[model samples]
Target: MAKGELVQAIRLLTAERDLPMDRIIEAVQEALATTYKRQYGPTPDVRVELDTDSGEFRVYAEKLVVIETQDESHQISLKDAQQYPGEPGLNEMVEVEVTPPNFGRIAAQTAKQTILQRIQEAERDLVYDEYANREGEILNGIIERVEPRGIIVNLGKAEAVLPLQEQVPRERYRITQRLKVYLVKVDRGVRMPQLVVSRAHRGLVRRLLEVEVPEVFNGTVELKAIAREPGSRTKVAVAARQEGIDPVGACVGQHGVRIQNIVNELNGEKIDVVPWDDHTDKFVANALRPAQVIAVLVHDAERRAEVIVPDGQLSLAIGKEGQNARLAAKLTGWKVDIKKESDAGGETQEAPVPPEPVAVAPGLPLDPADEPATMAELLERVPNEGRDEA
Candidate 1:
């Protein structure tokens, strides 16, 4: 390449690739050596070096002095060595410049491929470093492409993999759609950082609360625990660190706008914000919101509670397929046995029954065994079994 053009290209590469000048220079020097080796026979002990300041590449051959020439490229006669730099002795090594003619074209091709590969590798390392320290953070991204195993989300500077297990079951993806993803893990053991991000993680809700609620971000209110069924419902237990904060009200916001935003983000999923209490009975009662709990009998030894509600509130407290009780149990870290006030005769009991199929309508899921119900009430009966957060 021409001197001016080479210098300009180097400078441009250094700026555009965000790489140091020394790295580019080193790569170019290696490329020149490789090209020279490929073009010329391997008989000579070829060595390539660069003048960093002048950007000059010089190839040399170290040939041993021999009395009689065997291989022309590897051995030099004593007379020839003596003619070159320094007085040479028998069996001594000397450096001889061996730059070949018409080799710049080969060097150009080798250098182009080498420099581009190095640039791409450097970009991967940069992206890895940037995200490795950002584990457990919530990031905004756009759906870049759909893959067979998962979706690739572009997080501005990098792309993250959203695996099938981490996706909401019923949610669909459109190209270029923006989304909020929770960064659950970062694997730096590989050449590229592997980010395991999730949209279904319970931590997503916690992070969204931190973003939407100033009280949570400022630490006035702390989220004690969260039990969630992705794409369905979430039960969050929050408490105020100090007095006068009103943790539940603060999280719910004025007329429920703050919580509504989170609900909207989850595609209209339900969220129940409950106050956290040090008292197990009170905490358990509050955790089962929109359900009236008459009493909660805590068994410290078994780490369980027998919750008794009024007869009419039995189905409400147990929820559809016992989802409400299950989530409450998970949030409190206790096994819950919800029972009617009349069933409180026993202290220790198992999980609640299915309420004798409710008697409102028969043969259909969530329908009582008796009369017809409206669609609104039918939709409200959806619940998942209490499950541990993954």
Candidate 2:
């Protein structure tokens, strides 16, 4: 390339990547020096300079300015230093200008390769630095392709890998599909910079909730915790700041519109909105949703709970395949064991079991299977069990 062309190229690169023009010149000069060493012998000390304005390059070889020199190869007399005013002082080296006639071909190729490599390395470092602090943040991407291990998402400047282990179960992926994912990890390896992305991470769910719920973002509502079986069900505990605001109602939106958006984003994943509480009993009771919790007996030392529900609500409390109970345990951070009134006490008779309210009444039978039993009935049926304030 012509000198003008090289200068223009450098200028374009400097502006494109926001790199300094002087740095580019230095990199090119170093590349040229290396090329020179490869072609000629290493005996000569070489340096190269470029004119920032003219885009003209000059190569220089340093030879010691010595008097009565034994070695003619690199020594220059004081007379020579005087003539070359820019030369080094007393026993110091002077830069002797040497313009290679036929070395431009090789230097040009080497310079191009060196500049490209430098830019790539710099770009990688930039990307790594920008995303290092963003670990666990939500990022939007398009599905570029699917490999056996996971899906490759094109996140503008970088390609993030959404691993199978990080994917929600039973979720389908398609090419060019727009999706939002959580950046689970940022790794710097020998080959390339990596951002391990995830669609199923609990953080993803949290982010989705934050996006959908303005109250969460504003700190009016706080998400205490989240327990998820991705692509199937998720239970989130939310709390409100103001006295009049209902945490559950706020999260659920009007007629469940808000949470539905988040669920839809997770491929129709079911979400159970529960209120957060400082009290373990209230929190656990809320976590086991749709199941009328007659009482929450907390054994704090063991970090476990004996959740008492009426007979009809036991199945609901346990959930299908124990999903409800499992999520409840995860949400509450407690080991929950469920029991019914009948299991606690009462004789088995051949007579038909009465309604829940009647069977669990004081001095009456404790039929655990009775549906929809009230708190009054449960206290009556507990026999000598203490009603401690949880």
Candidate 3:
């Protein structure tokens, strides 16, 4: 290629690969040096220089100046060295132009390969750095192809693996389909950056909330905890860092638009956004939404909480297959024993956990504290072994 074309090509590569010009130039020079050594014989030290702006390529044979040559390729007589640049003295090196007549073809081929390889390496690093900072963030991509182990998602600049274990059981993928995923891991690979992404991770819900809700993104609301059963249900505890902001309201958005968007993204997975409390009792109660917790008897040492709901709320709080109670326990990071006023007698019954709410009372609030009372008064409300909470 001509000098001007070579310079233009380097400029284009910088723009396309987003690599620095110096790196590309260095790769080209190194390739030219290698090519010169291979074709002209390897005994002499070869130096290649390319004017980044002018694209003027030059090759030099560097030989040590000596009174008498011991090795013809590496050493030159002092008398002969005086003819080269720097008018070298003994023990000093002198550079002489050794441009081969047919070198353009050989050097062009070698340098092109080297420059392309350099660009590829730089692109990999660029991709790795880009996603490293984005760990735990959500990204949208298209399904490129599926392998036996998992699906390959084309995430614009790179492709990521969504292993079978990380996929939602109820969700199916197809070619060219658009999908949203959470970047759960970034690992180094031999040739490229290894990215492990997921749709089933609990962090996916938190990331989606940050994306859809401005309040959550701006730090007005904080996601204190999240528990998820992929393609089934997710329970999130949100609290306002600053007073006067309704944490639940902020996450749910106007008319529940914000949460609904997140739900839609998760393929209709139900999400329950509730308030969080530092008080264990209150936090447990908040976690068990759609179920009224009359009071929570906690064993701090055991990290177990006995949640008592009114007889009427037992079924609702336990949820179908006890999903509500299960999620509550997960969200609170504690073992929860759900009892209705009737279950207080210490008998446990299996509740059918359905995907949807069954006979849930919409008006029932988590707290029934309209009437404040002392601990003794509250204990009086406990059922006689027969009372349990839902």
Tens-digit lDDT track for model 3 on 9-70?
Answer: 98898898778888888888987898788777894678888876776678888778899998
Position 300, candidate 2: lDDT: 90
- Counted clashes in each candidate structure: 9, 1, 21
C-alpha TM-scores of all predictions: 0.72, 0.77, 0.77
State how far residue 53 of model 3 sits from its true place (Å).
Answer: 8.9
Error of 3 at 353 (Å): 25
lDDT of 2: 0.72
- What's the C-alpha lDDT at position 141 in model 1? 98
For candidate 1, the 10 contiguous residues with the lowest summed lDDT are 356-365
Q: Positional deviation of 319 in candidate 1, in angstroms? A: 1.3
Q: Write model 2 residue lDDT over 149-265, tens digit each, in one string.
A: 569999987888876666766888899999998886677644567777777666777788788888887889887877777777777777788778777777777767888788778
In candidate 1, how many Å is residue 1 off? 4.8
RMSD of 3: 11.8
